[model samples]
Target: MTQLPPRFEISRQDIARVVAVFYERIRGHPGLGPVFAAHVDDWPSHEAKVTDFWANAILHERSYDGNPVEVHRRAGNVRPGMFDTWLALFDHVLAREVTPQQAQAWSALAHRIGRTVRAGVVDQAKGPGGVPILR
Candidate 1:
């Protein structure tokens, strides 16, 4: 019989820590930094918002109230394919910050949210001909 890994409760502090580290990486990333800088005017506030989002998501805390899809759609410089880079960086950060199971769970949630946001951005970018420009 195969043994399963022990389940550990993830806390808000853990989420905050991960968010802090992840954004630090993002701030230094050549591909993602410029894109983020164009949209985010305040790094501290943005980090807090992201930490709240993840804490609410992972812990079911109901702390985040903003619509992420709308936010992403409003980011004109955010390309559809940027989610891939974002997720890759997120996964890399998670691997160093959390257990494998935790990382997998968080990564899955991130991917799902990323797809939803990307779809919204794509849909909003449709031309009058109803064709997406694939940006």
Candidate 2:
């Protein structure tokens, strides 16, 4: 059995800090802001949910249970291309808010999630024979 890398010692406070900063940037971004605004009716609740998600993912807390892929698919406004902008903002905030080790560890997970979400969106948009449907 392959041993997993030792988890980074990030606290819930640290996760909350990063989530707060990251979402603040997302809410202000031209491309992402409107997309989020269209889907998210309650900012505080959404922020709390996101914080829980990050805390669970990074700190191994078992608090978050929602299916992120299904959430993004239901969002309808999120496209595959948006992951780039999201990750860029995420990387920026992660660098400023966390230690280098934390940033690296969190970024790897974030990128994997981003790619999965993007693929889910893309596959949903594609028809048989791998051709993308015109929106």
Candidate 3:
């Protein structure tokens, strides 16, 4: 049986642009910048890998090969809360880079992926349940 194609159309170039712009913003973000800086020594290589990741997720291409959850969990510095900040910035980039339909679809996929990553990272850490996230 033939597999159905992705619901929305997005190109490798589009993914590359989004990844590039998003990372540029990330490097400047106070909360996220430091976190990413601690891990990523090379921005262009990181962006290319991330572009491959999105292409695999959205375009069904076989460019990316790795587990994001495992990477985040291993990072140790990646907090569960960081996914929110990451997604927010990513969505902002999507809004400016892609068509609205593509952005919505990509954002939905991203949130789903983000939640998985968050769950994986959160499982490795513990906090007092009664304590609030923000004081």
Candidate number achieving the greatest lDDT relative to the actual structure? 3
What is the C-alpha local distance difference test score of candidate 3? 0.87
lDDT of each: 0.84, 0.84, 0.87
Clash list (residue pairs), candidate 1: none
lDDT of candidate 3 over 68-112, digit per residue (tens): 989988997888778888999999999999999999999999999
For model 2, the superposed segments whose C-alpha errors exceed 4 Å read 1-6, 127-130, 133-135
lDDT of 2 at 118: 84
Greater-lDDT candidate between 1 and 2: 1
Global CA lDDT of candidate 1, please?
Answer: 0.84
Query: All predictions: root-mean-square deviation over Cα?
Result: 5.4, 3.3, 2.5
Model 1, span 1-135: residue lDDT tens: 554332336887888899889989999999999999888888889988998887777766666889998888888888777888999999999999998989988888898988899888888887778988565
Error of 3 at 45 (Å): 0.8
Model 2, span 10-62: residue lDDT tens:
88888888888888898899999999999888887888899888877776667
Measured with C-alpha atoms, the lDDT of residue 67 in candidate 1 is 95
For every model shown, what is its TM-score relative to the native structure? 0.87, 0.88, 0.90
Error of 1 at 54 (Å): 1.0
Q: Residue 32, candidate 1: how far off, in angstroms?
A: 1.0
